[model samples]
Target: MSEPALNPLLVELRERIRLLEGGAARVRSALPFGVPKIDASLPGAGLAYGALHEVAGGGPGTIDGAAAALFAAGVAARTKGPIVWCMTRPDLFFPALAQAGLHPDRVYFVESDKEEDVLANAEEALAYGGLGAVVAELVRLPMVASRRLQLAAEKTGTMALVVRRWRRPTEASDYGQPTASTTRWRVSVLPSEELPVPCVGRPNWLLELMRVKAGECAEFIVGACDASGRIDLSTGPAHRQDQAGRSFVAG
Candidate 1:
């Protein structure tokens, strides 16, 4: 008895599947959001290392932009090496990012005159493997540009953060356009947590994971990443009270 020869295309596909399996293992071991709901929704229970992630602020201004920037910085803070922040705006408050656990000493800022230039610089940064993460603040990112960034990240295992900003609220709708990012998120400023002593407490954020390749879109209200860059599920009055109690205890 003789066996038939295997198809060359089939063999190639099998090899690719094997490689994907190995890649999946790496992604599973990457950094987590610390919030079970968010982590569980991502592929391999964590954010993919060699992928491009898009984040957009809910409105225009320092506060709205800070929400999105801090979210990206929090994730970057968790990764090893220095963070590269590429932005067209020079008004980035280093203190704010430091409060998110991304200190200025560990951050390298790249200022560009235009949003396109910022994105271009970001792609170059992502292609480099030494940096921990690359954050690009851009008002517009076309599909071709995003896909290029995605490919650059894929090659080097570097994480790319696209912080989409807009001059107008209507301009933000561009986020709905197609992109090659692994996950697309909208980070909105949520009402600050109330303390029992009649003052504000830890900041909160409304995170909408609008698109995830391996998981369905989901929304969560989470305690903003603390000084250590960790966020947990923060919803309901009970949760707020618990946070207040913990703050008092720590104080």
Candidate 2:
């Protein structure tokens, strides 16, 4: 005897699953920095999508904080969709973000008085699945909350960036604690390049890869983000340092 006919609904479900699987592969792809040295240091040769990453200033000073925020803005500017920025403070410098290539119009701000609300808003935005990325400025991120954000990002193929901020030096110490983020970075302002004329040249930054999953920690001196959100390798006497002590200068 012949087997029972296949259910039409079941056939449709199978097709949908197949399509989703293909999309998932694309969704989990990496965003390359276009600078070989930096991209090579990251797993998959770039920052992975559908993951949670953390960025913080190297110190509690406003200069370091601004550098860190601009670094994140540059990353978000390169991605495709709208950005959801959740923050407790309303002091984001829009022109600075614009200079970093993240146009103000593409960003949607979720302002709240509490850090908890900011994280909650970020989680919801990540789950929505259509955003380019979700950025949350917080003083502290508990492991449990970070885990939730990571899972949401993985499920929807959205990137989550947590910018750690502190009102005081003591609160900045909280960043030392661990979280579920795939990578953690610290950006510190460095002296700008000396120009031939008596004017300020492009800014520079010391980018420290404090933590990475399945990758070695490294550091690089790089030019600050320009109008197109791209950072060039510093032209200074080139040197490299990794956790393993491997060193090479990329020409």
Candidate 3:
């Protein structure tokens, strides 16, 4: 049977409607982790762009906090263009960030005494567009503030990364509160890899995906960020929980 010819007017009309309604024209973009096991478990097969994500330390220890910061740095490093980092504290070690592939040259730091000011600067940076990412370090992220940040990121297609910190150990419980972030992650320090030499090896981390929008929770015991900001799937027998043995099944 011969197929009927399609209507050009109908096709154009549908396209116009889609754009007007912010449908296909505004499709969600993704940043893949480049690891099949991890990417497969996330929506869009990767981290969604134009959205807000939260990362925190698993414990109150300094090592845990540094791990969380490095994790966020690795994420931002993978992206292109300049970055805006707003923090209440001026304690960021640039040399450590360079090791995670995020160089100080590409970053513009905004140091403020108040957390609210830091968040406001982050929101403004996200809305400015043409940037790679905006990172904000704050102790608490309220639902309303998160929603505002989410909207700003969506408008400019900028990735918003929130690094949650706490002065008091008890305040860590505040992360359980609801927010508009697309995903929440916790990074905990793990023992370093064993080496033939009697010296230290590359770091390892327990990367936990606590909450994800439209996705289940999951965790991975993987090699820590390298100089290029990429993490490797553990090949050691002790870390055989990776794709070689068990695949990443979102829980």
Candidate 4:
């Protein structure tokens, strides 16, 4: 005796149900940035659904590295959920983070002595879907490890930010770049533009947006942080003008 044949309409209905479930899963993924402009520049109008983002610093005193962390923190803050911060350095200043619009209460700091340990912990955190974001600071990140983290992020729908400190070799392999990430950004502190008023600092930054997946890049002068810990466009002048007495002489 043969088993009854499955109904074709029933099979089609089951496939549709599976597709809807997958769509819902994709929608559940977290975004890693709050800046509207930045998010617009990224694929999917945000970070990839589940992917690892790499932030590499030029040197020890590089403010770019700190900016990268703050960027992720800002994203987590906007998410309104707990953030897991894993780092090899123990000297993380909560106050500074607060100044960058990140609530210390929402952040969970984890310290690790080895880079590998930090990555491992970050992967674990990524596996836990409850986290808004996971940040790990390390000296080096292998391609294989990053791929694993990316996979885990997709499964859990958590955004992963990896801050890489300066190591012997500045260049990295293709895999070192988060293959799953919608975009990659390299931040650095350029000389702040001087304000017209004495003792007042100008809001300016040399921000470089490098897209790994799309292989595109762009540079822009962004406003600096203000009293409210937000980027204030009003703090800077609309355009540069010459003084009344200045001559329009050509060099």
Candidate 5:
């Protein structure tokens, strides 16, 4: 009788070992973000290729929220091949995304009036291989739904991003609930660098890695995303001016 109980435990142990092996493979094939300060905190020195990541606006539909969208777009721009972007918002400015490196030419947009449909499209897109990435904007993501998305992405080596958006401020507060994402992020906008010519500088963002499943939590304040979505390392002068903000400043 005791032997039967031990058999079940042994089987579970084997399953856990298999899952660990798969995770190790993902870490080996991570996409390098290229910033030493931020990269050091991640398991693979970059975002894992076949994983699900969540990004949220700083305050839901505020300027910080828009910054979060642009940040996600920049990451997508780094990927090769076509991308499927699903959302309910008709206000996505094409020119802005072009500047962030996600060009309109390579992106296919899917708009739906229903929130559930958006997630459904994302799951299907993630299951299909050979695409750059899948980006979905939604307000709620149940644990089961997220788990399905994760499995789908894992099957095809695709990266999926859940861009959380809420119509009301109260709804935004609910994002703290648990999900099956490999990581969760909150992007906040900060004042631009004051230039010598008295004009606005390139975009700046406060990227908070709220939860990271396989590595230490960290924050990165990335300065501009080039046409190819490459971010240079932080400059020396900026670090000296603010010690209170323990953020990684990458250009």
Candidate 6:
């Protein structure tokens, strides 16, 4: 008889390699963002297989919570399943989300009172595996807690978005910036020219990709949101002008 199969440890290693290759293939096929530029900026052209992303703003009246929701919703809308939005505050404007490309019917909202509970619930949802994305709103994220959440997300290949609503700079408790996220972003509303129409006014925002783990940090200006909830690229004067409007002069 030939040598008995092999050590149990060797068998397990082979199986693990097979599973890892399978998972890598799946991740390569998944594209989380409909926006090409944004996708290019993110690792793997989308949210990584297992990672915590943080969204934070300066202070109250910033509407950073809404922006986070919209961003997650937009990604979820492009993904395979519905989105789970867990929040301590009830100010997530569904209309604004609809304006950001997420269908109201595809969103599942879970309201929680405590920040810890919100994080726990989000971890649970991310572990479930069927949801497209999970968003949690909290003020701070501890390293231990984030590690647990990250492990859960990795097991299920789900994306976790954490919204940090810090009112003051000093309130950031966990070391520098108070976040255990793999990537961090700061979003703020920017001034837009007034429009005379009765439709939803021109939407503009200053999106800052403040931190990235595997790539160079960069910033770009994204114009207003249109009816389809897509960012409009023709808002600037350069894009608005017709080809004939340009004056050609000999260099």
Q: Whose TM-score is greatest here? A: 2
TM-score of each: 0.80, 0.83, 0.83, 0.69, 0.81, 0.71
- Clashes, model 5: 1
Q: Tell me the number of clashing residue pairs for each predicted model.
A: 0, 0, 0, 0, 1, 0
Per-candidate local distance difference test: 0.74, 0.81, 0.78, 0.58, 0.73, 0.61
Model 3 vs truth, CA RMSD? 12.7
Q: Write the per-residue lDDT of candidate 4 for residues 1-251, one digit (tens) a residue.
A: 99766334333433553464442333365353445665556656656646777664322324336665655555556553467788877766677677667778767787777887787778876765555677877665666887888888888677777765543444433324444455566554434557667774643444456665654565444554432345422234444222222222111
| Model 6 C-alpha lDDT per residue in residues 85-152, reported as the tens digit of each score | 77788877778777777777876777778887787778866765555667787777888888877787
lDDT of prediction 4: 0.58
Which candidate number would show the highest lDDT if scored against the true structure? 2
Clashing pairs in 1: none
Q: Which residue ranges in model 2 land beyond 4 Å of their true spot?
A: 1-28, 60-64, 237-251
Q: Taking the tens digit of each residue's C-alpha lDDT, what string does model 2 give over 63-120?
A: 3378889999999999887788989899999999999999999888878888888887
Q: What's the residue-level lDDT of 172 in candidate 1?
A: 72
Assess candidate 1 and give its lDDT: 0.74
lDDT of 1 by residue, 90-201 (tens): 8878888888888998777777787767776777666645557888888888889999999988877878888887776777778899989999998766557777798778
